[model samples]
Target: MAIEDNPSREALEFEGQTTVIHDYAAKLVPGILQTEAYAREVLGSGARPKSDEERDRLLSTRLARAGILGDFHSPVMWSLLDEAVLRRPIGGPAVMCHQLRHIAALGEQRRVRLHVLPFEVGAHSLLDGIVSLMWFEDLPPIAYVEGLRTGRAPFCS
Candidate 1:
């Protein structure tokens, strides 16, 4: 997911409507897979720094996007992670530990498929950002591409 002053509205609406999600991340953990503490830390780490209320509100919105993953019936999430995401501790050791365990548990439960690209693999495309592809039952698929300062999730059919 793209963490910004305001999260991408298109991406949010699209995710809620999609049937399958293919996510690839090179830096940070994708939103749907983030734990509460991890998400809080990320949302609060903005350069402008939000007030407690603002952070809480944003956190709630971010987490709410994951609700679709709760149902066992559909919207399968396939996550491809670059090794750096696992190596970097975003919210200190405790929070990081919980985050890792959460991802692992999700994999064990077959909720989300986790694919980690090791550091040894070295230099590759999409190393500087995150991209997510979504498929819908009644709509055409689209891709969300997030860069250092830009996040575009326009729908295409």
Candidate 2:
């Protein structure tokens, strides 16, 4: 599921840190790191949006969320991506090239750390879904998992 699908006010208010494990095979991207073209394609294609307008609205929201990454109190973010994510051309060659370059640029920034899990790693744990963990200064961490068309945040010890 896309971050746009999870319009939680709490997530917007969060000001701390975040860690993400992303497998593009599951059809999702780490929101703070997606390019406009890449996000447009993913959100538009997968949701079968009712109309172009709706798709644009959703895409806008998703892209807006990325703005938090640029805020003065932005969270320190780390993203681990499956190698397949770098290989997949979600929006054709030009779009993908731009997306990858964007990711590379983010890595050059001080606030984000990006890593790729090469296929050579073979099979291991966390193959079940995409996971995102957010840690806040004054609240318990929250974990969000995505599978198929749904997502859940099961908060417990």
Show how many residue pairs clash in every candidate, following the order shown.
Answer: 0, 0
lDDT for each residue of candidate 2 in 4-96, tens digit (9 for 90 to 100): 554422344342244332223323456556788987887667544447876676567667767776754677677778887788898999999
Candidate topping TM-score? 1
lDDT of 1 by residue, 1-157 (tens): 3355546445667888888999999998887788999988887785676899987877787688766677787588999999999999999999999999999988998989999999999899989788999998988889888643346776475
Q: Measured by TM-score, how close is model 2 to the native structure?
A: 0.78
Relative to the true structure, candidate 1 reaches a TM of: 0.89
**CA error at residue 71 for candidate 2, angstroms:** 2.5
Residue 94 displacement (Å), model 1: 0.5
TM-score of each: 0.89, 0.78
Query: Cα deviation of 109 in candidate 2 (Å)?
Result: 1.2
The parts of candidate 2 lying over 4 Å away from their true place are 1-28, 47-49
